[model samples]
Target: MREWLKQLREEKGLTQESVAAGSFINRAYYSQIENGVRNPSYEVAAKIAETFDINPARFFAGKISEPFTLALKNAPIVVAHCDLELKYTWFHHPHGVFTPEEVIGKTDEELGIYKGIPELIGMKKLIIEKGMPMKKFIVFQQHAGEKTYVVFGEPLMDESGEIVGAATVSMDVTEE
Candidate 1:
């Protein structure tokens, strides 16, 4: 991803200092990002993409296939996988109420949280039962608070092509 970003900047005849200054980010930070010494935050990526007149999603093309943990280290999102029973199996919490250990074997219902999102419930059901993938925007409401998220969910298939679970990559969109 760093290489791609650098290549794009070079192709655009843009310099690190100029791009960073224009994008309202520090030149040193941008330099580090280009040099592969540090990963850019999602916000920084968006700003840089905007400066280059590219959609941020398009700018990040091919980046999502990178290791989720490495790619999402500074992203305001959570990536999680759940069994067909809706029991949480694993999660990467960039920002979330639940921790890795907290929800490993429990459902949100069991934790008394984030259960008010009808859209998410339906999407998970579809993934588990019909092996469908979903890209959805949802507002999750728990008794404590509410947060908007853009969620992507896909069925996890077993060796025999049977759906065994669901994987979700959700970004917090409340600030946006």
Candidate 2:
């Protein structure tokens, strides 16, 4: 998986530093992950996915099925996926207020949607550092109203157990 991921990174013409910027992770951290000296959390996976323009599931292809919940696409829960570069791969927004066009090609720094949330970036860093899954409770304040969401992130590893990417799901918990 390291080779595959390294190949992907090379193919994309991105440097480890470029990928980790604003990703809440240091370049040395990612380098260790790639070298198999460290494990990566889901957040790291998401950042990498964004950097490489690949699906998070591709990193865990053999370990897990595609992580998408087809039924959740238009459901109340809005799921999203990103890579190490903080790019959004998939976003399921039932209300359509958040479209893929608004996310798919952009980085976290580029997207203002999560600009003010300190924990959003923190969570991503924690995942990369721990090489494990993590959860966070998030509430968004918008002109329409306020909504609460529970986010779950899991690291995607390659066949040899190297961290490659991450997949995330956001389930709306608004009572109203």
Best by lDDT: 1
Give the per-residue lDDT of model 2 (tens digit) for 12-127: 68787877773568999888867767767777877776666576544453235234544454577766666666566555565746555466645556666542245665666667
Q: What's the TM for model 1?
A: 0.56
Positional deviation of residue 131's Cα in model 2 after best superposition, in angstroms: 1.0
* Model 1 per-residue lDDT tens digits across residues 6-70: 76687679999999998999999888877778766788878876787543543343465358667
lDDT of each: 0.74, 0.65
TM-score per model over all chains: 0.56, 0.55
Q: Candidate 2 local accuracy as lDDT?
A: 0.65
Runs in model 2 deviating more than 4 A are: 1-70, 113-116
The per-prediction tally of clashing pairs is: 0, 17
